[model samples]
Target: MDLNQIRNDFPTLQEEVNGKRLAYFDSGASALKPRVVMDRLAQFYEKEYSNVHRGVHYLSQVSTLAFEDVRGKVQTFLNAAREDEIIFTAGTTESINLIAYSYVLPYLGKSDAILISEMEHHSNIVPWQLIAKMNGMDIKVVPVLDNGALDMQAFDNLLTPDVKFVSITHVSNTLGTVNPVKEIIEKAHANGSKVLVDGAQAAPHMTVDMQELGCDFYVFSAHKVFGPTGVGVLYGKFEVLDQVKPWQGGGDMIETVSFEGTTFNVLPHRLEAGTPNIAGVIGFGEALDYLAKIDVNWRYQHELNLLDYAMKGLKEFPQVRVLGTVPGKAAVICFVIDGVHAHDVGSLMDMNGVSVRVGHHCTEPLMKRFKVPATARASISFYNNKEDIDQWLSVFPKIFKFFG
Candidate 1:
């Protein structure tokens, strides 16, 4: 693969920081948008902008069609069964909250429990806790091994009939560990429980087929996949979604309204309320198209190659302590120096013209599990090449000197 050609597609790659080219490595937080995605957003706003499904003008008709077309694009992207099963939300955080508030919580009772892993982002953990607290349900945590892999034996012990729902991250944002979600789903189904796979970290790196995985629900964010923010996807099986109660009320999601009674709209519309993020969703569609044409297998190999080089180079330093050394992982790496706060490390790296994420990464519990205050992280993507990793590593040994 011509890595330079791929880098050129992103206009941001041309930018210089601190007199050097910007080596962005914070893709786990949010991916840098491609030129196509940004152009699509501008095109929609300039020519085809309108509030969807609420008007009968030229722009509205065009906008509504384009808006709903995105749902179909997303449906095809994830290999979901039908477009009606896809609902657009703010992002992964809202997607999980929707499941907790609208889908799972209604069916759960006092005797029920929700199962989540130790490596989950706060989005997955907090919503379930909120619903569990309100419904008198218990939350069961699956611990992680020293190497940051899930303790599946403990998971087996925790899986019982009482576990009405199992929500776990498909990839850890902090650890880059790709979990055995398909196995988790099958096991949960065997025990008569529904499963929701958080795909925020997984969607950008690999293929996500809802039908093949057999998870009842799946969620991912657009910004993390080279699309715009304020938009994401929540996919549910139609049969299961038919049982969920509506959480929000407005415009297109209502079938009929009365002074005494009201009826909700069908499948996805019932779940989506208010004026939608029309332009963001439209750009998200093009982002999916961008991903479909690329040789993702090559991208995966390239990323893994960069990761291996980064890991090998990082291990040579005495002060650097790597976190999450699972056998199979994504290109992401998290570590901290001996006496530096993660934020300070990140600042020094910034001065060296490399951008990375630092601190707890919204996984305070995972930080607690590892007994660290925080860690500096370099979250890689296909756009990042070996030079980006080398740029990061070049600054690591000098972090203390730069700070001094």
Candidate 2:
């Protein structure tokens, strides 16, 4: 990938943060939007600004077409079996909550269990906890090994007929571990349990094939994948989505409304209850187009190359301790500088034009499991390169002096 060409597409990459040239390394939290995505959002509101699927006028027709076009692009992107299986939501958190409330709450009971990993983001963890509590179902946790890979042996023991559902994050946002989701899905299915994969981290950094993974549900946010915020994708198997009741009620999601009873609309419309984020959805489609035009393999390799450079530099820091370096890890390096809190290291890095995430990253349970209060995370994307890692390496050593 051409770093100069890619950098030109993201205007924010050149901006100064904290009075220093920005070196953003927080792609895992939320990626920076490309010029195409930004321009698409602007053009959408400027040209086709109207409520979709309700009015019969020209503006509505244009708006509705733009909105549904995103659904088609997303369906193709994930290789979903059908367009009706894709439902849009606010973001990853909302998408997961939708699945939990719509499917898990209604189907699971006292004898059922929801299995998850200790390394999951809060989006993947708390939703199941809430549904399990509401339905009197048990929440089972699969352990993480020392290298931050999910304990496959422990996972095998946990997969039993009692497991009603298994929800696993496709990548650990904190650990950068790429999970073995296809195998996990197959095992879960054998035990008669449905599966959900949170692709919030996976879709942005790597290609995702929903049909091949064969999970019951797969969810991800648009913003994390270089699109606009307030839009997310939730892909479910047709039969599973058919059985789920709509969580929210109102607007175009109804066939007949009455004071006594209301008949809901079809599968996807049943779940999408309200006027959706039309502009954001349109921008999401543009983002997908932008991604498709680029060579994704080259992008992945670029990110991995930067990760390798950063990892090598970080290992040389006498005080630094790198977190999970699993064999099949993605583009993330979460670590803690010795004798200094992660927050302090982040502050020091900022003074030198570096930006990194420093906190629990919404995985409080995983942080506790790792026995660290928090960690400083440097997550790279295609826009980043050896120069960015070199800049970080040049600045990071001062953290010890700044705190000493």
Off by over 4 Å in 1: 400-404
Give the per-residue lDDT of model 1 (tens digit) for 1-404: 67898788899888999988799999899998889999999999999998998788999999999999989999988899999999999999999999899888898989999899999999999998888878999999999988989999999999988998999999999998889999999999999999999999999998899999999999999999999999989999999888888978887889999989989899889998899899999999989888888877887888898899998988778788888899889888989888889999988899888999999998998999999999999988999988888898899768857655
- lDDT string for model 2 (1-404, tens) is 57798898999998988887788899888999999998988988999899989789999999999999889999999999999999999999998999899889998899999899999999898888877778999999999998999999999999988998999999999999999999999999999999999999999978898888999999999999999989999999999888888889998889899999999999788888889999999999999999998888888988998888788887778788877878979988899877789988888888888889999999999899889999999999998867788888988657666677
* Best candidate, lDDT: 1
Q: Which run of 10 residues does model 2 get worst, by summed lDDT? A: 395-404
Q: What is the C-alpha RMSD of each candidate to the true structure, in Å?
A: 1.1, 1.0
- Cα TM-score of candidate 2: 0.98
Clash totals, every prediction = 0, 0
**TM-score of each prediction:** 0.98, 0.98
